[model samples]
Target: MKQWPFYCEQECEQYNVSSIYAPYLFDTSLLFFKAVSTALDLYGGNMSFYDIVTNGTLIAQCSVGELTGATDIKCCRHQMFVYNKTPVMGRTHDCYYNIGKKEMAYIRQLRMIDHENVNKLVGFCMDGPVLLSLWRYCSRGCLIEILTNDNLNINIDGFFIYSLIKDTVEGLYAIHRSPIEIHGNLSSKNCLVDERWQVKLSDYGFPFLKAYEQPKSSSEQLWTAPELLREPEAHPTKASDIYSLSIVMADLVNKNLSFENSDYNGGADEIIYLLKSKTSRLIRPVLEPVIEDFNIGFTHLIKDMWAEEPEQRPKIDVVRKIVKEMNVGKSKNLMDHMYSLLEDYAASLEQDIQGRTKELVEEKKKADILLSRLLPKAIAEKLKSGQQIQPEHFDLVTIFFSDVVSFTVLASKCSALQVINLMNGLYTIFDSVIDEHDVYKVETIGDAYLCVSGLPERNGNMHVKEIALMSLELLKKIPDFRIDHLPNEKIRIRIGMHTGSCVAGVVGLTMPRYCLFGDTVNTASRMESNGKPSHIHMSADANKLLTEKVGGFVTKSRGEVIIKGKGVMETYWLLGKQGEALLNVDE
Candidate 1:
């Protein structure tokens, strides 16, 4: 073999031990002497010093040491994961290097090490069927998985790019500062991402033991420094790690696989071959089409990072400083950036909700106004809330009934549309007059309108006064009211009211009517039917309530005429007011 080939190469090296033989990590340790003696005994012949080291795996097994007492791994079918309370992830690798004191101490040191950007090594299973190294599980996968997943749904802008690249750089920076000194394995795949997009570096250093554990795949070799590929026995230096970081940066910047748009068309193997073979034109990932839009400083810095010569690349500290400068006024944490985005979204959503709420309120007001016409407001509210409204009895409420006099004769002279227009016009005036007093307009049947007070919402003794005023005002509006179709004819209404105890309720499911029941409503209708045109007729009870209980009105006696239902009931004429002359309905 021309060069000593190892999977991870001399990634973990002690600089002071270079003066000693370069073939093994621990030449001074007792395990190294024992291994050498064992190797010499097995060979049983004279061999050159160069020949032993040049044999690659032979010298490696003879030179490196191993820690003893590796217990067997057990598996119970029923209680397999009963003691696995701590969160951990296990991985297997090729059995090549043994665990010496140095490798054992390396594992302990890694277990002790804790950093935000580093994944902690928990323990390992060496004596098991396979070499299993456990680590804390990262929920979100590596960088490539995040970038390639079509359903991630995250909008990758400059800030997103900044956050990911920033995290990777920070992880590399931490490793460089750690006791391990250099991250031997620095690839996008080795960089595990979390839910918040934090990047943590895993599987680094301890090159001797790791040499045969993880053999390099062609894709994994894409991030390797060209010089490391050229020299088979070379160690992965800080500069080489920086080279790996540059490849990852390119992956983030371009938002694709490493060297995805490179000139090598023959796939990963061809690209690795090209990377080793130096040509006039350098073989590196191009910044490409979006390079102009990137920060000028970042673009130049990135190019410097991937320079062909190892010494030409900037230090990790310098790279960190420049990256920090690029993010001067920006958020350091991705979670903070996402929170800012959420706040902005919430503000806009709140405005939209407020607009919808305003429109709902306006529409509800319109519906309530229309509903008040159909039933009393209290009753309508009860029905709206799915509450059944029981029939309510008012001890003393005034009921008013009115009709357009000779309505049949008038309607017979006109078409249906004209009759409707006439009634609408007449009621429009009466409705306007009724609004001034406290009364609920119940229902209108043809030309007859029934209005009442002190039932759904009661008022003390003022119902008779309200009814009396409303009746007079309605009759007063009759002379001025004109029919649109018959302009010359004046509209007259015969009004009758009775004050007595009666029951009021919503009577039906479809097109509900707020109807009044008992003799008071009937007597009031009879009074209106028996009334003269252009006057308000009142029952004895209503006249008594108006004149005595609530004295505010003027009335005229329509002497003892036998009522149809009740015999010999004396009624009265509701004239204008106490101050005005009585309205002459006798004409």
Candidate 2:
């Protein structure tokens, strides 16, 4: 057998006997040799030397001495006993006799030892020829024992499995987030189950002391990450720990030990070989099949953690978050019988979502139609989409208000049917002009038409341009009008435009209508009431956004004009028809 060296391989010529190791003055003395002997014995033959030192300190009062080998050592489990004494000691402790108390104190001060996840050191005391320390006990045994137990059977339900995975992840999260990385030995034995079957991570450290002496070449490379296994260049990292954890998860899912169901008596080489090759598939068959049978969302998550490239694994924090999302204890049975029920539930949910989406679309269409009829399609869309349709306050917006100028006179001369036909013909042309330039026709009062731009919704600089287009188009179509079954007659319409901001919103819940109220709206109405037939009166602010984009009308400032609600506003008159230029210019 190959010899493993200590952490510091330098040899010491002088051996120091621990003060705690002394012959008991008498068998009846509280500080007896027998108690010290038993404490040291329990630690001597242990799988982990670190566990020995710590556990010895807790159960027995003694100082620890270095152990070269078990031979010539008499500290056996049968000899250990607790003695009520001022001093304690061990006999036949030939390895080291007088280890200084100060050195043990120094070891306690190391930051790695102080970590909560690390095995805690209670205190060090002395007994005759023995040294002792304390540690937390795990009854279910180390991960090694659990994994090596061939007869071990675990039939944990799926929900319990989920919870265990989550708990393990949280434990790992704490370790990985600490200043130092804690690489858990990936085996079934280290994960100890308490009374309630809740898993508690035991063997709480990497045992740096043992690892230093353990040859890197001889270490089990199968549990290691690919990068670490392939070369000596890569040092251990948190991601490496994650890789080990994924393997543990695989074993739990399979309900088998992590050794690929090999016989328990196999040597380390045989176990390592099986683990690296065949055992690697344990996690796959267990995790993949289970998720495929239950929920497929997390199957990819399991695969990602076992990725050959360490960097591809999700960070510990992300893993915690993913595990937290899983619903544990939500399901009872783990058989294939629930498959049909789950499928039916999923189908029902999908159908519900589809129905809701369809209903929303139909509502949107109906709302859009109503909005288009009330305001223009363009303004309606802006409002429906919850865009900022600012009430421009005192800011000037061009308001275009128009009507059939000869409506009353025509009605008095013609029959009722003839009058109705004539009105429809004129309003249809007005509607076309409004649609063409994206202008909102506010409302009509008995053949009186009202439209505006840059008021309820700010058209910015384009307000006047739109009004100019609508005005020119309406004027052009007026002269060609002929009412069916009625004598041909020439009629002119007046349109007024003003630029200012006005308050606008949905009014009256009973018949919710988007209405504009403020000086801007009133002044706009006044412009049309005061304007002449075939003319478009616009405010100065309305012209700014136009930037002469339309060439049909000759525009000139009408100077300050007294208007209702607006004491006086600078207005403009759009004088008719540069037909070819107007048709060519894009609004």
Candidate 3:
């Protein structure tokens, strides 16, 4: 491998600057050698040294390495400058070379003018590649970003706007009193905001270094005074800084970028050209909409600060006085105002929580009502409490089975929706009658409804009487129950009841049912199929409970009807209550 040396121009006469960079240069040569070895091995060691040197593609492809020795690449300065996503530390990398009395005085002046609103210049960097001025970084970004950010949900009322304006004025006031005597570039972009919403004016007081910098763009010149625009190289004056301050004030007032809503929609370059013209058009940002909320004199004061003649503009102290007057009755500081905002939020906190809790209670009540309809109230409570329900036995309870007569023929002639409407209309009348008695509704099949008067909550032998009275009322309502699809034709249902021992329990996990399992259920269903339409049929056990035990019910003998499941059963036709007239029931 060939040896190479590196040096900078300044130290060329003393030594090949390579002596200072010898360690790093040696590592570079070793890396090149490693790459050649990799390339030669890749090609089976068939290439000559001339062939290896000439193969640029092979060397480029073999640049990968896992070297152990490493050193940080940095400027020769002793202090390490750390970089972060939102760096609290930064470097300028352009401190002027001369560093004479004027430069020293200017830096000293900047260091002394460190007010809360003005950025603090920490120190200088001279030993690095370029000179640097270290400044305390403002992490909350600048006024330009704050005003232009649409996603930011800050409660920016008039009080917040006044605090920012007050801070900017105070920073400029501090600079005007210092030896530098002017903030050469005062744009919203340079006015940074801190985490606490305090504005700190940056990039101020570096006139000597600024002379060598690039020329300002037309967009940047939007805030420049007319006099400064005419004499481009003339040093920035206190009056020009005031003019720039007004442009920033316009941005805060309108909550936009500088001159973003200009009347001359021709953009920043066009606005600069129009202002530079000799015509008497006093070009300034429109300050109407936001200013109306403040004192009328506030608008006049800002216009005076940016007057055409430098002599007519108010000094920093005079501008500060008017700002104080405009904010006389307001909060003394932003912190106090923020505390007041928190107090207001806390005041309404209890009421908001109470209202939400009341709505939650109402919604829970509605859900419970719906759940009770799906299952018996006692069973629903047991299920909600995670109780295991075993099959329960009832000695004597009346089971009522009901279904529409000729329902298949009626539904076949109507549409599906119409059949649903017909079922709903007839069941609604049955449900209202059932509500008058003490009974629990079981599951409803296609045209069949199952009900019981004693198991979930038993009511002694009164279950037979309750079921008997409910069935009579249900048959009475069928006369007025008209089908919407078949208007002229009347609807009818056959109801049957039996009283005997049965087992009942909740059945499944998904759509669990309060199901009954016994021969009593089968006998009641058989009684319905054997009975005539518009009539209530009862088995021997139910009739004995109603007439002998409960009394007041009138029943006629059904007489050894051929029940499908039970061979032959003597059922009875329940006519009406003893004191009431007999129902016009079909035989």
Top model number, lDDT? 3
Quantify all predictions' global Cα lDDT against the true fold: 0.76, 0.57, 0.79
Per-model TM-score versus the true fold:
0.51, 0.34, 0.65
For candidate 2, lDDT tens digit of each residue in 357-461? 999999989978977797656556777787754433536556767767767877788888777777777788888767777577777777888776765556566
lDDT of 3 by residue, 217-319 (tens): 8987887888888876858999999988988887888778776776777888888887788468788888764534545565687889889998999988998
Model 1: per-residue Cα lDDT over 325-391, one tens digit each: 9988764578877677668767887998999999999999999988977777788899889999898
Which model scores highest in TM-score?
Answer: 3
Better of 2 and 3 by TM-score: 3
Give the range where candidate 1 is weakest over 10 consecutive residues by summed lDDT. 74-83
Q: Residue 564 of model 2: what lDDT?
A: 67
Regions of model 2 farther than 4 Å from truth: 1-364, 375-394, 414-421, 455-457, 539-553, 556-572, 576-587
How many steric clashes between backbone atoms does each model show? 1, 44, 0
> Which is better, 1 or 2, measured by TM-score?
1
Positional deviation of residue 280's Cα in model 1 after best superposition, in angstroms: 15
| Higher-lDDT candidate of 1 and 3 | 3
